[model samples]
Target: MSKIKIMKKFNFIIQSKGGAGKSFFTYLLGIKHEQNKETLFIDVDGSTSTSTNQLKFLEDQKRIGVIDLLDSQDRIARDRLFGSIEEIAELSYSNYILDFGAPESEQLPALFSRDVNQQELKGFAEFLNSEFIFHVIIAGGTAYGACMQYLTDIVRVVGEEFKIVVWMNENTLLNYPKQVEQILEAANALGLDVERFGDVLSGSVFDTKLSTIIQQGLGKAGIMKSGYMIQTQMKKLTAEIII
Candidate 1:
């Protein structure tokens, strides 16, 4: 008999520059995962409250775990926030979709900073890798140029151990495919081997029935028309995502 693959998937949806659809994409991925796999969501963007609200539907379903890192500028708050991540990473066997928000957005990069203990962070990465196929998925909005900068910064800090996935989130006036081309050109200019990077997964959730409903903070209709739209887009996006 053939053995089954049981690799846990940990997707940290990130972008230092805000309004890049981090929360939106996180919710989509979480909903998709809940169809089968055990999933957990950590909303670190307490300021925006977008993902926190959009995810309420799932929370009510009692199908997944959700944590909100409190919004604060205090150093202690940052510590507790980072501590929660470590705590969940240690205890959970389910797949994780961590939606990072403001302030503490720098925590992941700080772990690999020269000022911190790189050795310890590296060991933690190893532990996570042992249990999960850890990947960092970045969502870039219409400001494609700024998104490229964030990508490079993360690539520099995290090193090459983790797979980096680029998501072209269409929110601006710029063309989606063009932005993707520019991102690749930028990555090549930075000496990153494009082959190792996961394929660019692009989509837009704006003006959709689901988005409109969520924006209005209305009650769930149960089996919504917009849900089908989201699932269709997510199916394509997830298919492109190399696990």
Candidate 2:
């Protein structure tokens, strides 16, 4: 294997609410990291595996991997997840971006609520010499309440050891301006970093076209190839990401 680059951070895109743009955000972050570092994209979505699907090209190149936590009985297999973590710990250098599905998202925070799991994760981060940053989504519209609750739950469980980054989706921001403001205030009070997306990702004609390309498993290269308008939007969206 090629020498892995020293990882700076292990980023996780997590949100319990579906349609909150977790996979899209993960893809953007993966592309950003891929530009400069040896990065691994892990899709832990047992159900849809949308991130895995979108990043299939990268997986074929061995830059992406999948670890479905659900067992044959359709339950979250904790032991299997820990085993995967051990394998990743052995590769302590390359940066990892994990896009978690709704069920796995909830389970991870819950796991962090336990002291033993928290210590284990802290040890893993220490061994890798990387900071753990959870990129949680706080969207608007009908998902606002659930998203906010999930954020609070994560904060409550992860404690002060791990860093939390909030990604505010702009698609429904106008519809729930007050709620968005509340989230901003809370994030500010908590001193968590906030990133805004969806200006270009808002379901426009070009955005729809871009989404279809991504879903077709062409990844970033496809976006770059599909005309200038989509490429421009993809660039703009990726530019706004601070992770």
Top candidate when judged by TM-score against the true structure = 2
TM-score, predicted candidate 2 vs. hidden true structure: 0.87
Q: Candidate 2, which segments miss by more than 4 Å at Cα?
A: 1-8, 34-37, 71-78, 114-117, 201-203
**TM-score against truth, every candidate:** 0.69, 0.87
RMSD (CA, angstroms), candidate 1: 5.5
| Per-residue lDDT over 1-243 for candidate 1, one digit per residue giving the tens place of the 0 to 100 score | 996545555666677666656665665565455454366666766566566677666666454455665434433253464467667766545566777764445455654564434455456556555332223333434455565666776777664555565565543424456666776676666555442221223343434544665565333343244567654544554454333
Question: After best superposition, candidate 2 residue 88: deviation in angstroms?
Answer: 1.8
The TM-score of candidate 1 is: 0.69
Give the alpha carbon lDDT tens digit for every residue of 37-123 in model 2.
Answer: 367788889888888788776765677778877777765665776677668756634567888998888777666655346667777
